[model samples]
Target: MTDKPHHPLTIDGEPRAFFGRRSGKRLHKGQERLFQDLLPTIEIAYPETTLEP
Candidate 1:
């Protein structure tokens, strides 16, 4: 698995703040699988989104 940052946002009247990742280590295989499976169910998708590290 790879190390990546995840930021979860709450969209209210004007995209209110919610929860997110500041920094962390890498994830093991089990954790990676869980994140991959659950992300599609709960993740918010925005067009043209890109990650800059």
Candidate 2:
């Protein structure tokens, strides 16, 4: 398991606990290509509103 940083929206800003294989396998070549090709098209800018702590 890896020690991943928690996104602020996560439970009280704690690292998530995982009990199973997080990702059983790495992305295949075609999947990798598609991710590279498509991710930017669906992305959004971060919200400008102030976040509650």
Candidate 3:
């Protein structure tokens, strides 16, 4: 017997893989504040190469 492989699976017609929990307990006030305040600065943004060159 072989162990089942661990991989992400996508259902038909979906654009991305379907996996993981969709919902969880609501974030506490502190957690919410962190997300709101820090997310903007920490998030990734693609820079235009032409502008930089």
lDDT scores in order: 0.63, 0.66, 0.65
Tell me, by TM-score, which candidate is best: 3
RMSD per candidate (Å) reads: 15.5, 8.8, 8.6
Off by over 4 Å in 3: 1-19, 43-53
For candidate 2, lDDT tens digit of each residue in 1-53?
A: 23545423345665555566655688999999888998868867677997677
Sort by lDDT, best first: what order? 2, 3, 1
Give me the displacement of residue 50 in model 1, in angstroms.
33
Q: What is the C-alpha local distance difference test score of candidate 3?
A: 0.65
**Order of candidates by TM-score, top first?**
3, 2, 1
Clash pairs detected, candidate 2: none
Candidate 3 collision pairs: none
Q: So what's the TM-score on candidate 1?
A: 0.32
**What ranges in model 2 sit over 4 Å off?**
1-17, 44-53
